[model samples]
Target chain A: MFFRRTRSIPEEYLQNIGAHDDLLRALFVMTQFDGRTVLDGVDLAIRRGEIFVILGPSGCGKTTLLHHMAGMLPPTMGSIQIDGKDIYGIPPAELDELRTHMGFSFQHGALLNSMSVLDNICLPLREATQLPEMLIRDIGRIKLDMVGLIHAQDLEPSDLSGGMRKRAAIARAIAMDPDLVFFDEPSAGLDPITAAEIDNLILKLKTVFGITMVVVTHDIPSAFTIADHMILLLDGQQLAKGSPEEILSSKDPRVVNFIGRTMPLADPAKVDILNYVAGVDSRLPEPRGANS
Target chain B: MSPSATESVAILMPSRFDRETVPALLQEVRRGIHEGQHRICLDLREVESFDSAGMALVVGALRAAREAGLQIEIQGVQDSVYDFFSLVSVERLLEEPQALPRPGFIEGLGGLALPLAEGSQKGAILIGRSMWGWVLSPFRGQKLRLGKIAEEIFQAGNGAMFIVALIGFLLGLILAMQAWVQLKIFGADIFVADMVAVGVTREIGPLMTGVLVAARSGSSIAARLGTMVINEEVDALEQMGIHPNRYLVAPKVLGLAMATPCLTLVFCTMAILGGWLFGVTTVGLDAMAYIEQTHQALRTADILAAVIKGATFGALIAAVACSLGLGVRGGPEGVGRATTRAVVTSIFLIILVDAFFVLFVKLGA
Candidate 1:
């Protein structure tokens, strides 16, 4: 029987993040699905205990980058190091052990609709810990309380509203008290008020618990609000990486348009239906009745 | 090792204190408690790996100590274990379990019955819509794609041809040999042809074909529709003003109904040919005489019965598959459950419908 040989993290990858002593670092990471490149040679570093945001437009590989960082997707090229340990190079068992310290909250609140919210939250603890059922449930309840969703624990995921589902998902993600949590589009489908509340929750979890967070989202205001350090992705490449203030004041037109929402709106008069209808009529032979 | 209430009982934890090993270690603790040990000291110095079950055992021991007015102390706790305990707050584990209100008997009964009632109602609605699409719609100028129905027919019938033929031939050969052995002593060996023809046409051919098709096409339909429901493709169809029953269920139901009888005809022919082979070579009967005897024994009623039973079984299978598939909920597990239930239920209903056909034939005779 042949086995795929596993390699250890190389020495140079450690030196790559040595400058800032970064906790999580991506070096020239590129991801391609089939022949289509989704993430091009993207490089960024996340310092320990900071709320790092990955901001991009729709289909700009924001989630793809997060998945790669979490060791869910192997990059087409380049290396990702979590605390100077190569995520893709190591053996699967080591990767599994490393992943136990991290949590991923999916974009769709991918809670198992078959189970109650409380059970969903307790699932990780039940699987990973030797804690008694009651103790695990207690931990689950605490997690739900942290997300302000204690009362909705008994309800199924399908019963919860979009915002409530996202909160429930967050509760499940933090159930393990992971050192690092990856949140994918936490504010995607919620109303402004609910979205702001989620942002505040994210801030509170960081400030109070001091858990390092990597948030991937296209919502600019939410990103700016929660992000201590941020990176902007455009067309699968890193456009900019800096503090939120630095990104806000960038001179690039694309960055400016993305940050300030200053793109020109369509002129209604030029796009009117009557104009197009008349234009189409003038180009064709006139109707015999109208000509007559 | 000796049990003493005054002296603390020291137990060294295993390297891998997981769910599998926790039970035996727990039994050891229990045995010590029964042997009059008042204080237990669990040593975790050698422990390299621990799972939820290990923590559960610790919590259980703690709870037991407190209730029994004894003492329990954990020594040399690893950093990983300590981190988990600290995060969850060990005090929270010691708290008494909260009592939740249990539902009344009537409420519990209603809880089980409500889903069943809802499912049956949905199943009825699906069957009605499917009938409308299969039988009524074409007469009313609704143009369902003939290509889709043709594809389903090919899948249900032609795809299953080889297996059906093999089973039918084997069954006929076995049945003829058995009948010959039994009839040879009674000087009725020539009646083997009559028995095989009647049995194959009236019972075995349609029954075996139904079971095979149910396992094959029924599971496929259920899994396909269940995945569609999970992926919101079913909802997409509804959004586009297309009835899922008409678009999806009708083709499958109509195709299976049409194809099952045709398959039964082939199965019956193959089976008679097998019996003829057995009677001539093994039993030393004339081949031409065996064919003539089979023709004389098989009535129009038996052939019609086989076709009718095959069509009914096919329709039932499709209906069950489509209903379960369209009604799927939750995730991939839900799709899996639906598929399993579809195959089991289809097979069960096939046997049931077969029994009913046998009764009807007996009564008609």
Candidate 2:
């Protein structure tokens, strides 16, 4: 459950840490699937009222980390403290109370296809509050307006375009004016314009509401645009944690390769296509003839 | 106690602190806090009933008081209210209470009973709504898809006709042949017709048809709906605010209900024909005399009972199938399990229902 800090904490990141108290703190958080570890000894401190984006390649446990942070999945080791309360250690009722102030936007809209856009937005409000239909409808309308989905309120999730569905899901996520919001791959599978629009919406929501946002994505452009602070994960390990500028300038080879989109070079002497294909030894063999 | 300069007067809590009373009570308590009361005490001795809304109200007031740099205390708390607060872990606001003991075997049984009761309740609602869907369709401008129902009827009943006829014919022949050997010893071979007609019409015809349909159509229905559930189409329907029972189940129930009795009639007629064939060819009895004996043994009530049983079994099979299908989870494996469960449950219910009908008939007689 011990994580070795890979690099010195960036001065700006340290300043950001000093600026606001941590709303979410993960201490030695680890997750295992079957026998293999998915997230290994991860430590993170997400400050309040800031956009914290988790950047990772596929299978790097970005979504898993997000789920752990959101209390949807329990870590194999360590603890996640949300607002100084141990998320998993609390009783169900207390956990529900904590969750009431939080919202999660899934990667795929996950909007109930049977419900109209309006009802999808209204669902959480209706479930969590005893407010009358009229008030609930007004609130739903406001959220739809925020997401620019007022014209499509009467249509089903299936009837809307993919970007519209994502917006609708975002509308539903923010419907309760939650203190914390988590978005999983908001810009994934979206066109660049739609993706930028989603990124802008994320920024606007954070700016206007002053709510903390945690976005998990591999979309590098989207991450750079929206993140005030970011964590780069590789093989379930934190490779770097800092602002986008610091991350871009990181001397770490992995960070440089990832940010620069550089492919790892392979030496001809170390080539073993057959072994690699068989998954027997994926690592490059030692140089056999190096100018000898 | 009277209000003093340093000691605040405790507000008397209501006996019933539920949704109806809590709103007004919360407002009054908030007003009291706003009126320069730094120390507030709530008298909870009178509380006979308390719900989550009540707890929320009290918690909200406490939070507001704390935010305003005031203090609040609870006094004379009733045991029941105290227990509820402890159960909900709200005792963190006060002092932590001892953890309650885990439930034992009997409690586990009671826990199991809840879901069973809930499932039965949901089944009843499904049945009621499906029935109403048929009854009110015309007025509601919702057309019952006769084409879909017809397809189901054909698949469940008409396609089943060949097997029903084959089994019915074989049963009649076997019954008459078995009875002929004994009757021949006493020179009463004419009674073979009587035995076969009564046995097939009263029991075997309806029972065999039900079991066949249960295996054939019931499993199919469960598999179809279970796949739909896996595909999230059922969820889609639910999201659209349409009841799966009314949309998916009602047509099948009505179609099978109509078709079953007709199949039962065909089964009984074929069985009698088979007996006549056996009596004339093998027993050396007069064909006309055998037909007359079979006719004499057959009662109008017996045919009516068989038809009623057929209709009831049909409805039960469809309902059981639909319920199991709707409850399916996981994936293809779940659909397979649901299909197996539907067949087994339908057959069990068919036998159980048939036995009840038999008991009623006997009592009436």
Candidate 3:
């Protein structure tokens, strides 16, 4: 539990951010075991009113990248900034203030089953803010209502289906109307209908609050549909960066294989087919869409 | 003057520092610079994110890089992080970190099964929680310690009552029938009444019923509660500021304490009735004759002794059940094991307690 993600008011976020803002310049970066850096040298600008998505393959470390951005994880190198101040530059009082406005959704929703959905949603506020019960309930009701989960507020998280739990978790994450939000693999466990629903909810939040968003997912379709800006990572380094279209058109073989629009010689059977059946040499195919 | 606030500026930001990210990135940088870790690679590998602390660290790193004549490389930068570098001038200044060799494909194969490498961390939590409960005596208050008297009654007495009554009645019948068979072999059939009445009221009724109650209820309480303990729900409560001992164990102990003695009395009554039924039917002894002999045979001490035994056994059974329950290990299987231990221990303890009660009453107290 101690190694888990943290959020606080601007003051607290600032406090935790103390003295660290001077050094950091990377967002959600991880080093490779072999000392060859992956998620290579990614730099991003997530505006206050934008949907920024890091779209990549299963091993591209998009989730790791998201964690870096959200402050759930510490980067080996680099800094994240909020407002004019580097996220870690602010004083403790200011940092705590910042954590209050940022909402993070874990991949599994991670709702506490012992708590009712409403109470689960209310946890961050209870931990961080001294808002009155009535105020908290009102906020919870509003968030749940916005997500169409008002009726399910009293139910335990286990009682709800997978999709409903995400909505409830989202409601909880946004219980404070955070200015910035980070979501991890929102569509991973959900069916198409539910995945689409979560996507739509994400878009709705973006549009309504004009809040900054950083989303991480392997769901290519959802990522393309929702990302205002998308970046791809390969082997812990940024494989490609730009729009969803930019990623699709990447000549990088790793990028081509990941987005699934292009064929790459990953399956051993595919290589055999090319050499024997297609009358081609045993070699990796050149990417068709780099700089397109 | 400062290139107009809106214009993006290139600040020579620190690249790799330590494991932390964001504002703390700069903090580490500052500390390093203060500690003179110049020419540092603000390694982007481990960094997750940062707030102001990261920014400060970056600034400190940059400043250190400049002062120490040490070069800084902010390599492995994610796109979102690039914005910070540019704003701070590191985008224009810092170079990328050096790349080392990659593992060969064969060596890399070991890192596979990430497909199967699902983190089983969730299970560890459940085990840690129960073990913590077992180690920490959370089940202690003035009147409500884990092995304390009140705790035992709720766990043992109430849970085992119905089973005790049923077993006691069956024991009475079996004892009566056994006596009746032998008595009928001779012309002393009427004396079967005396045998059963004395047997049930004095010995078999109290002792057998308590043992049966211990077996039926004690094990069950241990298993059910032990499973709860092992599952980490108890630890979760402690984390949430609710003391598990007070919230979970106290009430159960209190409930069992109140329930066991009453159940024992019921068990004794049922057994006496069972004995009377067997005596009248099998031996052809008139009910009045059986009643008169039983009255002649029975002593107030016997009744007192049995009731007293019931009370003591009830408490003992409860204490043992709770003690076992509180000792639960993680997982469903651990619960089953605890249940078995609770029943065996309760039965053994009940017999031992019964011996002492009878001896003490007969001898002096």
Candidate 4:
């Protein structure tokens, strides 16, 4: 009710990457949490390796939609098909086969804190492949280096900062070199400097490896900056989705209100694009001169 | 939507944020800083409030953005949230000069940790996680969590120590007192020491300790394992095609088996000591005679019986814990219920198994 924008017809629906842009699909899928619908009769498709951000306010179900894509959360009434294969109908064994091609970066970085950065990064390869330990280490090292964490290999995860933990998680996500990587709030709890580094890493993973990513996050700028395609979910249905630029420019009040509030609050009228930071106002003075 | 957020989280913040909402808003702020943009404005119009939770996010974001040398601004907050923020007045505390100071700890840890997890812990942790993966994973799938000899031993043996010691002490005292009361009528009260020594070392000491451990530690294992199973940690493993049980379950069982016996030996000592102190010094039995009778009754077979019971009980406990953990329900509450059930079930099963051991040693075998 607080977000009372009239539902305008989203313009991207016509050229919307809804069908042709679909790399995966679900038919009438539902998930129940305590007889309450966490996800109810949701139908949607996600494209491959495209950094597709799932955006929503808290309780809007951004994360739930992402889990469906990763097969982490199964729908109660519907089927999700990955690469055209119905996930529910497929045996559990087959689902695993599909997962080797997919990677997940959890909100906590899900790095096994019990493990070292290298071990967390190469976990997938060791679990799935018989590649020698040396080989796993080599690959893990490469990815850690990719995340700029090559120096942190032997250290336990407990020692890393919020940004480093995420980078470590990214290393783990890309270790198997899966075609698709799912990032659940890749930028949460990080400083802007570190968060941007992670965002750039997301873009690099896609650009360099051609990996498809489905990110679940409330960070509007990170979503707009990193995502090629996007989907907005509310009450277990797709509210709207399109390219980042399109989603941003659209007059759909729902879209406008969602982005407008979350975007760094500045005088929209006086705010100069060149002068504005994505989440902060440029009006705040530099600290160096004052401190001096 | 991601269950990890609702259920768990991505690379869970290494540690929980001191305040929850701050991190969410901080993330938004970080997004701005990363782009190296000069000015950023965050409108809290829809947010409707700026209490600790809301302000935490805004201030947290501003702090990070400032540290990154980006200008920060807040606009359009409702009365309630803004009032709460002012009430706390912590916003001014968070507001400061630009740029965050990089801590040596963060750089040091991630710098080294990422490599090792990617290297050594992969196989071991995967094996450990997989044991109960099938029963617990959100989607039906293959996975592995438990495996490795040392790990199994630790899970089984170490985790159950507290329960074992507690049971051992209580059982020892109970056995001595009960034996004394019944024997007094026959002028056999002096035999309480012998009875306690033989009974404890020969069976009760080892067996009871293990069963106790099974109940306490086993159930704990089950709950922890169960949650991991349903939460997709197990599925994540299986998707990687690692065997779940051999890695996850094997280690726990073996760990318990190895540790429970050692613990049982300690329990035996304590139970006998408790009985001796009470029966001889307090109950008026001749110390020398009691010691001799106890020695005579405590034969090699008795020791074997106790050790065997301890090992068996340990194995049972580990198996139950691992199985329950793996078979836990889907949600957090479900995982909790499974943990509670695992303990109750494991304890009961341990006692039942102990009874079978007693029967077999005495007659059936």
Q: Pick the candidate with the highest TM-score.
A: 1
Worst 10 residues of 3 chain A by lDDT: A283-292
Q: Candidate 2 residues A1-292, lDDT tens each?
A: 1222223334463344322468987777788889898998787888889999999998999999999889888788767778777688788788888897899999988888657788999998789887555446655655676677777877767677879989999988887778899999998999978887888888877765677999999987678678888999999999998887667656787876675552223523213422332345656433221111
List residue ranges in candidate 3 displaced over 4 A: A1-40, A126-131, A261-292, B1-365
**Which residue pairs come into collision in candidate 2?**
A114-B239, A114-B240, A115-B239
Candidate 4: residue B153 Cα off by (Å): 31
RMSD of 2: 17.9
TM-score of each: 0.76, 0.48, 0.42, 0.45
lDDT winner among the candidates?
Answer: 1
By TM-score, the candidates rank as 1, 2, 4, 3
TM-score of chain B of each: 0.74, 0.66, 0.52, 0.55
lDDT of 2 by residue, B238-280 (tens): 8997767778999889888878888888888888888889999
Give one digit per residue, the lDDT tens place, for model 4 in B250-270: 666667777788888878877
lDDT for model 2: 0.78
* DockQ of each model vs. true complex: 0.09, 0.04, 0.02, 0.01
Q: Please give, for residues B1-365, the per-residue lDDT of candidate 1 as tens digits.
A: 55466667888999997656876787887766666567888999888776545676777677777777767889999976665454344455565445688989999999756654554456557777887766766786766767899999999999999988988888899889999989999999889999999999998999889988988999899999999998899999989977787889988988998899988888888888889999999899998999899989998988998999889888878888899998887677778888887887777768877888779768987
- What number of clashing residue pairs does each candidate have, in the order they appear? 9, 3, 145, 100
lDDT by residue for model 4 over A72-115, one digit each (tens)?
76665666667666565667787889888788888887777556
Q: Residue B103 lDDT in model 4? A: 61
Cand. 4: chain B TM-score: 0.55
